[model samples]
Target chain A: MIIIGGTATNGIDENLSKIISVPLLKVEHKVFPDGESYIRIPQHITNQEILVVQSLYPPQDKHFVELLLILETLADMKNNKITAIVPYLAYSRQDRRFKEGEALSIKTILNAIARAGADVLIVIEPHKEEELSYFGKEVKIADPMPELAKEVSKKVEKPFVLAPDRGALERAKRLAEQLNAEYSYIEKERDRDTGEVRIKNLPELRLSGKDVIIVDDIISTGGTMIQATRAAYEHGARKVISVAVHSLFLDNAYEKLINSGVKEIVTTNTIPQDPSKVAVVDVSPAIARKI
Target chain B: MIIIGGTATNGIDENLSKIISVPLLKVEHKVFPDGESYIRIPQHITNQEILVVQSLYPPQDKHFVELLLILETLADMKNNKITAIVPYLAYSRQDRRFKEGEALSIKTILNAIARAGADVLIVIEPHKEEELSYFGKEVKIADPMPELAKEVSKKVEKPFVLAPDRGALERAKRLAEQLNAEYSYIEKERDRDTGEVRIKNLPELRLSGKDVIIVDDIISTGGTMIQATRAAYEHGARKVISVAVHSLFLDNAYEKLINSGVKEIVTTNTIPQDPSKVAVVDVSPAIARKI
Candidate 1:
């Protein structure tokens, strides 16, 4: 197998190579004077099984277009089989229309990827699993929960997994089981008329002097995590550690969470992050196991 | 008619509205912690003929996603008619397979845009006209040449239009006719063996003491324009001004062209530019005339 890494996934090729033996290809990219993407692949793969790795993270559109150009180039080269490994899939949040007139961007993005000659798509914990078929390709979803749980285990002793809300209970339960710790979820209530949200009944699990590990699939805006962290502190938690598969940390979410008394934040290297509260764990092993 | 503007097309909305007399809707957007695009269209656009103005230029992927979101939102909102006005269409260069097994990115992009509920796509001077049908929608192409010619008329005296190469002679001829100026094309020769390029024949039109306007649809990389500029200077042209519909001064192309002694560069407001070599002229009237 031949692995190709995009601009964001530069160092990741080494990680994937450690798990699976493959020759890695890197994209040489430059922005043209007219702002057009100029990409050149140095390696040649005539009839090899190709794996293209790129994360649709910040500067999402540029990375996405780069991926398309790479895929198109690979397709033109007549590669035998192609697998796209997108660690962080952008536009996954709009899986369904929340309200009338909402765009389901994920569906359109998936279709474009599939059309770009991606035979198989391997994503790590997309926002929703139900919409995986939207791409109309062979889809492989690698869950980073088990891997994230392993990272959480090393960070704290006397741990208790807390789901940010009821929706993320499954994630919390899985991580709790992996860590051999107690698991519980907070309740969230929204005022139907005013659209004001407030955290309802706290978890029944005793939180006093325990390392509270908040497990969620994604940490966008950090509103839910912030609220849960505040509740955890109020309920007598010793150290609040937030763990998620993807850390978008939009705006001042990380700063806000740190100020809200959260001790640590651990996330997978799905999205690019600067070293701070973000503890990026490798998910290559999980992807390699499936491959 | 309801006009909507994407992030890049904010100021252009007011210009478009001034011509069409419509309520302008702007998408308030932010990146989520998880890198998901959070877009909110403030205006109500139910059952109305909606025109969304977005230029898919640099950061092509993000702008493309925004356009998709807006289209999808309008679709979900059950808008009567959705018209997407993409000033600078990305992925237009790869309209056809240059080699076997090419992915044909433009076709996929068009399909995605069509699926996103863009009933009509209004583009200004896409790379090619033949592939417009690939969109499978009511595609209205608005040419900004006349408007660009009007801008050129004010910029120079004793103007003579010069196509950088033979292929763009048609465009140069059209613009020259519009400006009532003499037109000619330079001959370019590429060494098939060494892959080196050289300008062979200069234009027959005497370039001495006259404003020589180089015209083309696109000015990517500015290699051709730079070559043309050098040849014009060598042939004793008094002033050299480059004109194009899309000015994609990739990398140091802009600086290189300016250094090569081109007097001024004028491009339509199809793509964004800084206040330097590029002078952007508004083409809203052209689009509005069609609407």
Candidate 2:
């Protein structure tokens, strides 16, 4: 099997190399002055099962388009089978059209990727499981949150798992179960017009003498994490940390999170930011076994 | 001509109805349970010269995509001509790929709108004129800065035009020439890695008893405006006011600007924000003559 990793998949590739003995080939991506992207596989991989990994995070459309282009190039290069490993799928939040005249952008994005030539697709903890049909791939991975939390717990002692909001409670619960730690979720009231969320009933879950770890599937804007950290500190948490499957870290998000009271944030190498720490889980091995 | 307006368009239809004897349509947009968007136009607009006015300011992408879908629906309804009047165009800052592997998303967005079936486009004082080619339309217009400055000058007997940065000196000079006011530009130093900018030099441009008007094309974070206001107040200005063509105010931007000692903030109804004051310019008259 030949493996190609995007900005997010580098960690998965490293872990997979250590787990199994396989030859890997990395794709080099560059952009021309005229604003076109160029992608090339350095080594020949005729009839090889290729695993192309990428995360569709913020700037969702651009990253999704780049991934499609990469898949198209690999297909044309005569790769036997193509598997897409997307850690954090963008447009997942946009699953359905709430009103008339709105395009089902998530469906459209998925169709673009499938049409570009991905035979199997793997996603980790999608916002909604029903979105799986959007992809024409045969394989789908759901909820890698347990394994990720287990890996995080191994490094730290007495880690208390936290969910920034009730919407993220399921993932936090699953992670806490795996880590054998206490788990609690914060409630939030969001302003419909502005998309501004206010955390409520947060100080109730006092973590006065515990090492807290905020766990979520994705961190976009980092607003929730910041609010959670402030509440945690006010309620007397010893130290606060963050771990997520996807660290989207939107514009100025990293600095905001760090300045908001998070001692150290750990996340998978999901979106190619400097603060992305801890690469505990790898999907390449699972994909290889499934295929 | 058929006009569609909403909060995003700031009742532009009401203004247009006075000039032309055409039916005015108001667009109603709402969010559904599954976090999807819904849009409805109250009147029939088939085979009409349709003008859909909207601004993509804060909640930038959501409002932008909503406008695109509305345009698509209008095209599907067999409108004879579709013109999109976006006064406050967001993501224009990403015109160039500042870093490696970054996409020129502004162009992609323009292409998406064009593909969605907008025959002509109108924007007010885009950050750069070179971005006009990115759109596949001709009905572009400059901000009514001169006219607006004259009106503002009438309010304050003695006024001085100040450019927030050297990049905006031309605009300040133009406004100053129109109002016959003194003009000055701030020298700024931006940290490349963090995107943090600081004023490098203040050359003591005395405004001891004069009303200072800081002018710019757009205000996204309001950081520059905040610094400018502080500098103006420290320099003994009697009053400090901020005026911009497009107000792409992000989260907490308005509050931050207000707290930074700005006496009054004035912007054209480019973006539909409650804080926006003064709308001296209208593109409808100019666009009507052009088309």
lDDT of 1 by residue, A45-85 (tens): 68988889998877777777778777867877874598999
CAPRI quality of model 1: acceptable
**Residue-pair clash count for candidate 1:** 14
For model 2 chain A, give the 10-residue run with minimal summed lDDT. Answer: A31-40
Best by lDDT: 1
lDDT of 1 by residue, B1-291 (tens): 888888678367779998889978778778655455767676657878888898887777778878877777777777469888888888788677654444466875787788778899998877778788888979998867788888888889899999988878888888999999998999989899998999986556579988999988887888889999988888878989999888778767889989999889998887877856578878787788779
Against the reference, the lDDT scores of all candidates come to 0.81, 0.70
Could you tell me which 10 consecutive residues in candidate 1 chain B have the lowest summed lDDT? B96-105
TM-score of each: 0.84, 0.55
Candidate 2 wrongly placed segments (more than 4 Å): A1-291, B17-21, B40-47, B189-208, B233-236, B248-252, B255-259, B275-291
Q: Write the per-residue lDDT of candidate 2 for residues A1-291, one digit (tens) a residue.
A: 767775446576665555566655666776433233445556555697887877776555345656765676676566469888786777677666565444555665565567667888877767777787877567577555555765676566767888888878878888888888898987878789999877775546868788888887777778778998887777778888887777666667778888897877666554565634434354445444444
Q: What's the lDDT of the predicted structure labeled candidate 2?
A: 0.70
